[model samples]
Target: MDFPVLWCVLAFVAINMIGIYDVVHLKDLLPPLSMINAIAAAYLLDKYKLPNGLVALGIGVIFFPSMTAPIANLKILLGSAEPPIIYGKAPYVNPPEGDRKALGRWIKEHTSITDMVLVHSFGTQVQVYSERLSPTIYFNITQTPIAKARFYHDLRQNKPAMILIPMFPEYQNLVDADLRSFVSDLVKSNYHLESIMYNYQVFRINK
Candidate 1:
Protein backbone atom coordinates (compact mmCIF):
# COMPACT_ATOMS: atom_id res chain seq x y z
CA MET A 1 0.00 0.00 0.00
CA ASP A 2 3.09 2.28 0.11
CA PHE A 3 1.81 3.21 3.56
CA PRO A 4 5.15 4.78 4.51
CA VAL A 5 4.84 7.42 1.82
CA LEU A 6 1.20 7.96 2.71
CA TRP A 7 1.98 8.27 6.40
CA CYS A 8 4.85 10.64 5.66
CA VAL A 9 2.58 12.80 3.57
CA LEU A 10 -0.07 12.82 6.26
CA ALA A 11 2.53 13.69 8.91
CA PHE A 12 3.80 16.56 6.79
CA VAL A 13 0.25 17.83 6.33
CA ALA A 14 -0.35 17.67 10.07
CA ILE A 15 2.88 19.53 10.76
CA ASN A 16 1.95 22.25 8.24
CA MET A 17 -1.47 22.74 9.85
CA ILE A 18 0.09 23.08 13.29
CA GLY A 19 2.58 25.58 11.94
CA ILE A 20 -0.13 27.66 10.30
CA TYR A 21 -2.27 27.59 13.43
CA ASP A 22 0.73 28.65 15.52
CA VAL A 23 1.50 31.61 13.26
CA VAL A 24 -2.09 32.77 12.88
CA HIS A 25 -3.11 32.23 16.49
CA LEU A 26 -0.45 31.33 19.07
CA LYS A 27 2.43 33.22 17.41
CA ASP A 28 4.82 30.75 18.99
CA LEU A 29 6.04 27.45 17.51
CA LEU A 30 5.10 25.42 20.63
CA PRO A 31 8.18 23.28 20.16
CA PRO A 32 7.55 20.93 23.10
CA LEU A 33 4.14 20.07 21.72
CA SER A 34 5.73 19.35 18.35
CA MET A 35 8.09 16.88 20.03
CA ILE A 36 5.15 15.28 21.84
CA ASN A 37 3.26 14.93 18.58
CA ALA A 38 6.22 13.20 16.93
CA ILE A 39 6.54 10.72 19.79
CA ALA A 40 2.79 10.08 19.94
CA ALA A 41 2.61 9.47 16.18
CA ALA A 42 5.18 6.64 16.49
CA TYR A 43 3.54 5.16 19.59
CA LEU A 44 0.09 5.14 18.01
CA LEU A 45 1.42 3.43 14.86
CA ASP A 46 3.04 0.67 16.98
CA LYS A 47 -0.03 0.20 19.20
CA TYR A 48 -2.45 0.06 16.26
CA LYS A 49 -0.58 -2.76 14.47
CA LEU A 50 0.00 -0.34 11.59
CA PRO A 51 2.62 -1.30 9.00
CA ASN A 52 6.23 -1.11 10.14
CA GLY A 53 6.48 1.76 7.66
CA LEU A 54 4.52 4.16 9.93
CA VAL A 55 6.50 3.17 13.02
CA ALA A 56 9.73 3.68 11.09
CA LEU A 57 8.45 7.04 9.93
CA GLY A 58 7.60 8.06 13.48
CA ILE A 59 11.03 7.02 14.75
CA GLY A 60 12.63 8.87 11.85
CA VAL A 61 10.70 12.02 12.83
CA ILE A 62 12.49 12.36 16.15
CA PHE A 63 15.58 10.20 15.46
CA PHE A 64 18.27 12.77 14.79
CA PRO A 65 17.15 15.07 17.61
CA SER A 66 16.78 12.04 19.91
CA MET A 67 20.45 11.23 19.32
CA THR A 68 21.64 14.83 19.80
CA ALA A 69 19.43 15.58 22.82
CA PRO A 70 21.49 13.32 25.09
CA ILE A 71 24.68 15.15 24.21
CA ALA A 72 22.90 18.50 24.68
CA ASN A 73 21.57 17.31 28.07
CA LEU A 74 25.05 16.24 29.13
CA LYS A 75 26.49 19.60 28.09
CA ILE A 76 23.75 21.42 30.01
CA LEU A 77 24.49 19.29 33.08
CA LEU A 78 28.22 19.97 32.78
CA GLY A 79 27.89 23.59 31.66
CA SER A 80 26.47 25.61 28.79
CA ALA A 81 26.84 24.34 25.25
CA GLU A 82 29.54 26.28 23.42
CA PRO A 83 28.36 29.69 22.21
CA PRO A 84 27.64 29.96 18.51
CA ILE A 85 29.49 32.51 16.40
CA ILE A 86 27.68 34.87 14.03
CA TYR A 87 29.39 35.93 10.78
CA GLY A 88 29.00 39.09 8.71
CA LYS A 89 30.68 41.04 5.92
CA ALA A 90 32.47 44.38 6.29
CA PRO A 91 30.87 47.75 5.34
CA TYR A 92 27.50 45.95 5.21
CA VAL A 93 25.84 46.51 8.56
CA ASN A 94 22.39 45.19 9.33
CA PRO A 95 19.78 47.93 8.96
CA PRO A 96 20.03 50.25 11.98
CA GLU A 97 18.04 48.54 14.67
CA GLY A 98 16.88 49.52 18.18
CA ASP A 99 20.15 49.90 20.07
CA ARG A 100 22.12 50.08 16.82
CA LYS A 101 20.25 53.25 15.82
CA ALA A 102 21.08 54.92 19.11
CA LEU A 103 24.73 53.85 18.75
CA GLY A 104 24.94 55.25 15.22
CA ARG A 105 23.56 58.58 16.45
CA TRP A 106 26.04 58.71 19.36
CA ILE A 107 29.00 57.92 17.10
CA LYS A 108 27.99 60.64 14.66
CA GLU A 109 27.73 63.15 17.52
CA HIS A 110 31.19 62.43 18.96
CA THR A 111 33.65 60.78 16.54
CA SER A 112 35.46 62.61 13.76
CA ILE A 113 36.34 61.76 10.18
CA THR A 114 40.01 60.82 10.79
CA ASP A 115 39.39 58.98 14.06
CA MET A 116 39.82 55.24 14.38
CA VAL A 117 37.30 53.24 16.42
CA LEU A 118 37.69 49.71 17.75
CA VAL A 119 34.45 47.75 17.61
CA HIS A 120 34.09 44.42 19.35
CA SER A 121 32.33 43.18 16.22
CA PHE A 122 29.80 44.54 13.71
CA GLY A 123 31.73 47.69 12.89
CA THR A 124 30.00 48.67 9.68
CA GLN A 125 27.19 50.76 11.18
CA VAL A 126 29.50 52.99 13.21
CA GLN A 127 32.20 52.97 10.55
CA VAL A 128 29.86 54.11 7.82
CA TYR A 129 28.10 56.76 9.90
CA SER A 130 31.14 58.08 11.75
CA GLU A 131 33.36 57.72 8.68
CA ARG A 132 35.97 56.41 11.08
CA LEU A 133 38.31 53.51 10.39
CA SER A 134 37.83 50.19 12.14
CA PRO A 135 40.27 47.30 12.52
CA THR A 136 37.71 44.68 11.42
CA ILE A 137 33.97 44.48 10.98
CA TYR A 138 33.30 40.92 12.05
CA PHE A 139 35.04 37.96 13.64
CA ASN A 140 36.02 35.02 11.40
CA ILE A 141 36.51 31.37 12.43
CA THR A 142 39.33 30.52 10.00
CA GLN A 143 41.40 33.61 10.84
CA THR A 144 40.99 33.90 14.59
CA PRO A 145 44.73 34.07 15.26
CA ILE A 146 45.30 36.44 12.39
CA ALA A 147 42.44 38.64 13.58
CA LYS A 148 43.84 38.65 17.12
CA ALA A 149 47.35 39.50 15.87
CA ARG A 150 46.06 42.27 13.60
CA PHE A 151 44.05 43.78 16.46
CA TYR A 152 47.18 43.79 18.65
CA HIS A 153 49.12 45.36 15.82
CA ASP A 154 46.41 47.97 15.36
CA LEU A 155 46.52 48.77 19.06
CA ARG A 156 50.29 49.22 18.93
CA GLN A 157 50.38 51.03 15.59
CA ASN A 158 47.16 52.93 14.85
CA LYS A 159 46.08 53.33 18.47
CA PRO A 160 42.37 53.85 17.85
CA ALA A 161 40.86 56.88 19.53
CA MET A 162 37.78 55.13 20.86
CA ILE A 163 36.43 51.60 21.33
CA LEU A 164 32.73 50.98 20.85
CA ILE A 165 31.09 48.04 22.60
CA PRO A 166 27.67 47.67 21.00
CA MET A 167 25.56 45.37 23.12
CA PHE A 168 23.91 42.90 20.80
CA PRO A 169 21.69 40.84 23.12
CA GLU A 170 22.74 37.51 21.58
CA TYR A 171 26.47 38.26 21.91
CA GLN A 172 26.43 40.44 25.02
CA ASN A 173 27.65 37.57 27.18
CA LEU A 174 28.74 35.10 24.49
CA VAL A 175 31.94 36.59 23.03
CA ASP A 176 34.94 34.30 22.45
CA ALA A 177 37.36 34.07 25.40
CA ASP A 178 40.25 35.57 23.47
CA LEU A 179 38.21 38.54 22.24
CA ARG A 180 36.77 39.13 25.71
CA SER A 181 40.23 39.05 27.27
CA PHE A 182 41.58 41.51 24.71
CA VAL A 183 38.73 43.94 25.43
CA SER A 184 39.21 43.60 29.20
CA ASP A 185 42.88 44.43 28.81
CA LEU A 186 42.12 47.47 26.66
CA VAL A 187 39.62 48.76 29.22
CA LYS A 188 42.20 48.39 32.02
CA SER A 189 45.00 49.98 30.05
CA ASN A 190 43.82 53.13 28.24
CA TYR A 191 40.08 53.09 27.61
CA HIS A 192 37.65 54.75 30.01
CA LEU A 193 33.94 53.97 30.17
CA GLU A 194 32.49 57.10 28.65
CA SER A 195 28.84 56.09 28.53
CA ILE A 196 26.46 53.12 28.33
CA MET A 197 23.34 54.12 26.50
CA TYR A 198 20.80 51.87 24.83
CA ASN A 199 22.91 48.74 25.31
CA TYR A 200 26.01 50.39 23.87
CA GLN A 201 29.25 51.14 25.71
CA VAL A 202 31.53 53.88 24.47
CA PHE A 203 35.16 53.77 25.59
CA ARG A 204 37.41 56.71 24.83
CA ILE A 205 41.18 56.22 24.80
CA ASN A 206 43.16 58.15 27.42
CA LYS A 207 45.35 60.90 26.04
Candidate 2:
Protein backbone atom coordinates (compact mmCIF):
# COMPACT_ATOMS: atom_id res chain seq x y z
CA MET A 1 0.00 0.00 0.00
CA ASP A 2 2.25 2.80 -1.30
CA PHE A 3 1.33 5.85 0.74
CA PRO A 4 2.47 8.34 -1.87
CA VAL A 5 0.50 6.63 -4.64
CA LEU A 6 -2.60 6.39 -2.46
CA TRP A 7 -2.25 10.05 -1.53
CA CYS A 8 -1.87 11.06 -5.19
CA VAL A 9 -4.99 9.10 -6.12
CA LEU A 10 -6.98 10.71 -3.30
CA ALA A 11 -5.80 14.17 -4.31
CA PHE A 12 -6.73 13.54 -7.93
CA VAL A 13 -10.21 12.29 -6.96
CA ALA A 14 -10.83 15.22 -4.61
CA ILE A 15 -9.69 17.84 -7.09
CA ASN A 16 -11.83 16.36 -9.88
CA MET A 17 -14.88 16.18 -7.57
CA ILE A 18 -14.47 19.83 -6.67
CA GLY A 19 -14.21 20.72 -10.35
CA ILE A 20 -17.29 18.58 -11.13
CA TYR A 21 -19.32 20.47 -8.54
CA ASP A 22 -18.43 23.73 -10.36
CA VAL A 23 -16.63 25.11 -7.32
CA VAL A 24 -13.53 26.03 -9.38
CA HIS A 25 -12.51 26.52 -12.98
CA LEU A 26 -11.21 23.39 -14.69
CA LYS A 27 -8.12 25.33 -15.80
CA ASP A 28 -7.21 25.89 -12.14
CA LEU A 29 -6.84 22.12 -11.71
CA LEU A 30 -4.16 21.86 -14.40
CA PRO A 31 -1.25 22.75 -12.15
CA PRO A 32 -2.04 20.19 -9.46
CA LEU A 33 -2.87 17.52 -12.00
CA SER A 34 0.40 18.20 -13.82
CA MET A 35 2.28 17.83 -10.56
CA ILE A 36 0.55 14.51 -9.99
CA ASN A 37 1.52 13.42 -13.46
CA ALA A 38 5.13 14.33 -12.79
CA ILE A 39 5.11 12.32 -9.56
CA ALA A 40 3.52 9.32 -11.26
CA ALA A 41 5.97 9.49 -14.12
CA ALA A 42 8.88 9.62 -11.71
CA TYR A 43 7.56 6.58 -9.88
CA LEU A 44 6.96 4.65 -13.10
CA LEU A 45 10.39 5.42 -14.46
CA ASP A 46 12.06 4.26 -11.24
CA LYS A 47 9.98 1.08 -11.04
CA TYR A 48 10.27 -0.03 -14.67
CA LYS A 49 13.65 1.51 -15.55
CA LEU A 50 11.90 2.78 -18.68
CA PRO A 51 14.00 4.72 -21.18
CA ASN A 52 13.58 8.50 -20.87
CA GLY A 53 12.65 8.87 -24.56
CA LEU A 54 9.85 6.31 -24.28
CA VAL A 55 8.38 8.09 -21.23
CA ALA A 56 8.59 11.45 -22.98
CA LEU A 57 6.91 10.02 -26.07
CA GLY A 58 4.16 8.45 -23.97
CA ILE A 59 3.51 11.76 -22.19
CA GLY A 60 3.39 13.61 -25.52
CA VAL A 61 0.93 11.06 -26.96
CA ILE A 62 -1.31 11.43 -23.95
CA PHE A 63 -1.40 15.24 -24.03
CA PHE A 64 -1.08 16.19 -27.71
CA PRO A 65 -4.84 16.20 -28.38
CA SER A 66 -5.34 18.71 -25.58
CA MET A 67 -2.58 20.86 -27.06
CA THR A 68 -4.12 21.16 -30.51
CA ALA A 69 -6.09 24.35 -29.85
CA PRO A 70 -3.15 26.00 -28.13
CA ILE A 71 -0.86 25.01 -30.99
CA ALA A 72 -3.29 26.48 -33.48
CA ASN A 73 -3.48 29.66 -31.42
CA LEU A 74 0.33 29.88 -31.42
CA LYS A 75 0.35 29.64 -35.19
CA ILE A 76 -2.26 32.39 -35.43
CA LEU A 77 -0.24 34.59 -33.12
CA LEU A 78 2.88 33.98 -35.18
CA GLY A 79 1.04 35.01 -38.37
CA SER A 80 1.55 31.61 -39.94
CA ALA A 81 -2.15 30.76 -40.34
CA GLU A 82 -4.07 32.63 -43.03
CA PRO A 83 -7.74 32.10 -42.14
CA PRO A 84 -7.21 30.15 -38.93
CA ILE A 85 -8.46 26.64 -38.20
CA ILE A 86 -11.80 25.79 -36.60
CA TYR A 87 -11.64 23.41 -33.67
CA GLY A 88 -14.27 22.13 -31.24
CA LYS A 89 -16.96 24.17 -33.02
CA ALA A 90 -15.02 27.42 -32.62
CA PRO A 91 -12.34 29.26 -34.54
CA TYR A 92 -8.87 29.09 -33.07
CA VAL A 93 -8.64 32.86 -32.67
CA ASN A 94 -12.30 33.65 -32.36
CA PRO A 95 -12.55 37.11 -30.91
CA PRO A 96 -15.78 37.82 -29.10
CA GLU A 97 -18.61 39.10 -31.30
CA GLY A 98 -18.01 42.74 -30.37
CA ASP A 99 -14.95 44.95 -30.27
CA ARG A 100 -14.69 45.80 -26.59
CA LYS A 101 -11.73 48.08 -27.17
CA ALA A 102 -13.73 50.08 -29.67
CA LEU A 103 -16.63 50.30 -27.22
CA GLY A 104 -14.26 51.54 -24.53
CA ARG A 105 -12.86 54.12 -26.91
CA TRP A 106 -16.37 55.29 -27.72
CA ILE A 107 -17.18 55.69 -24.06
CA LYS A 108 -14.01 57.65 -23.47
CA GLU A 109 -14.69 59.97 -26.39
CA HIS A 110 -18.42 60.58 -25.82
CA THR A 111 -18.81 60.60 -22.04
CA SER A 112 -17.47 63.27 -19.75
CA ILE A 113 -14.50 62.41 -17.55
CA THR A 114 -16.71 63.14 -14.52
CA ASP A 115 -19.35 60.67 -15.59
CA MET A 116 -19.51 57.26 -13.96
CA VAL A 117 -20.48 54.14 -15.93
CA LEU A 118 -22.02 50.85 -14.93
CA VAL A 119 -20.56 47.75 -16.55
CA HIS A 120 -21.58 44.15 -15.91
CA SER A 121 -18.54 42.30 -17.14
CA PHE A 122 -16.07 40.35 -15.00
CA GLY A 123 -13.08 42.72 -15.11
CA THR A 124 -11.85 46.32 -15.21
CA GLN A 125 -11.17 46.14 -18.93
CA VAL A 126 -14.01 48.59 -19.56
CA GLN A 127 -12.87 50.98 -16.87
CA VAL A 128 -9.27 50.86 -18.01
CA TYR A 129 -10.26 51.33 -21.61
CA SER A 130 -13.03 53.88 -21.02
CA GLU A 131 -11.05 55.97 -18.52
CA ARG A 132 -14.28 56.43 -16.55
CA LEU A 133 -15.26 55.47 -13.05
CA SER A 134 -17.68 52.63 -12.41
CA PRO A 135 -20.43 53.32 -9.89
CA THR A 136 -19.62 50.16 -7.91
CA ILE A 137 -16.37 48.26 -7.51
CA TYR A 138 -18.09 44.93 -7.95
CA PHE A 139 -18.25 44.32 -11.70
CA ASN A 140 -20.61 41.38 -11.45
CA ILE A 141 -23.24 42.91 -9.17
CA THR A 142 -25.56 39.90 -9.55
CA GLN A 143 -23.19 37.77 -7.50
CA THR A 144 -24.84 38.78 -4.21
CA PRO A 145 -27.99 40.48 -2.95
CA ILE A 146 -25.99 43.11 -1.08
CA ALA A 147 -23.98 43.90 -4.20
CA LYS A 148 -27.23 44.22 -6.16
CA ALA A 149 -28.63 46.64 -3.60
CA ARG A 150 -25.46 48.68 -3.63
CA PHE A 151 -25.50 48.76 -7.41
CA TYR A 152 -29.11 49.96 -7.43
CA HIS A 153 -28.30 52.65 -4.94
CA ASP A 154 -25.29 53.72 -6.93
CA LEU A 155 -27.29 53.71 -10.13
CA ARG A 156 -29.78 56.14 -8.64
CA GLN A 157 -27.19 58.31 -6.90
CA ASN A 158 -24.63 58.51 -9.71
CA LYS A 159 -27.04 58.55 -12.63
CA PRO A 160 -24.30 57.11 -14.78
CA ALA A 161 -23.99 58.39 -18.33
CA MET A 162 -24.02 54.85 -19.69
CA ILE A 163 -24.69 51.30 -18.63
CA LEU A 164 -22.92 48.56 -20.55
CA ILE A 165 -24.68 45.23 -20.46
CA PRO A 166 -23.07 42.19 -22.03
CA MET A 167 -25.20 40.40 -24.64
CA PHE A 168 -22.92 37.45 -25.30
CA PRO A 169 -23.88 33.87 -24.45
CA GLU A 170 -20.87 33.40 -22.16
CA TYR A 171 -22.03 36.24 -19.95
CA GLN A 172 -25.58 34.91 -19.69
CA ASN A 173 -24.69 32.59 -16.84
CA LEU A 174 -23.00 35.34 -14.84
CA VAL A 175 -26.15 37.46 -14.72
CA ASP A 176 -28.96 36.67 -12.30
CA ALA A 177 -32.42 36.40 -13.92
CA ASP A 178 -34.07 38.74 -11.43
CA LEU A 179 -31.34 41.31 -11.83
CA ARG A 180 -31.60 41.00 -15.59
CA SER A 181 -35.35 41.68 -15.40
CA PHE A 182 -34.80 44.66 -13.13
CA VAL A 183 -32.16 46.11 -15.40
CA SER A 184 -34.27 45.53 -18.50
CA ASP A 185 -37.20 47.34 -16.93
CA LEU A 186 -35.03 50.15 -15.67
CA VAL A 187 -33.39 50.57 -19.08
CA LYS A 188 -36.78 50.64 -20.74
CA SER A 189 -38.06 53.25 -18.35
CA ASN A 190 -35.05 55.52 -17.91
CA TYR A 191 -32.48 54.75 -20.61
CA HIS A 192 -32.25 54.52 -24.36
CA LEU A 193 -30.08 52.19 -26.32
CA GLU A 194 -27.24 54.31 -27.69
CA SER A 195 -25.01 51.79 -29.34
CA ILE A 196 -25.04 48.08 -29.92
CA MET A 197 -21.63 46.46 -29.86
CA TYR A 198 -22.24 42.90 -31.01
CA ASN A 199 -21.39 41.53 -27.57
CA TYR A 200 -22.80 44.40 -25.49
CA GLN A 201 -25.61 46.90 -25.29
CA VAL A 202 -24.79 50.47 -24.26
CA PHE A 203 -27.65 52.42 -22.77
CA ARG A 204 -27.61 56.14 -22.11
CA ILE A 205 -29.64 57.78 -19.35
CA ASN A 206 -32.64 59.51 -20.86
CA LYS A 207 -32.58 63.26 -20.57
Checking candidate 2 for backbone clashes, the offending pairs are none
| Candidate with the greatest TM-score versus the true structure | 2
Per-residue alpha-carbon lDDT of model 1 for 5-31, expressed as tens digits?
455556556655533232323423344
| lDDT of residue 57 for candidate 1 | 74
Candidate 1: segments with Cα more than 4 A from true spot:
1-98, 136-143, 167-169, 172-174
Q: TM-scores across all candidates?
A: 0.47, 0.63
Q: Report the C-alpha lDDT of model 2 over 64-177, residue by residue, as the tens digit.
A: 777777987798789896553333242123233134566677789989999888776553566678888887755444455666777777666666778877765555666677
> Compared to the true structure, candidate 2 yields what TM-score?
0.63
TM-score of 1: 0.47
Candidate number achieving the greatest lDDT relative to the actual structure: 2
Mark the 10 consecutive residues where model 1 has the least summed lDDT: 85-94
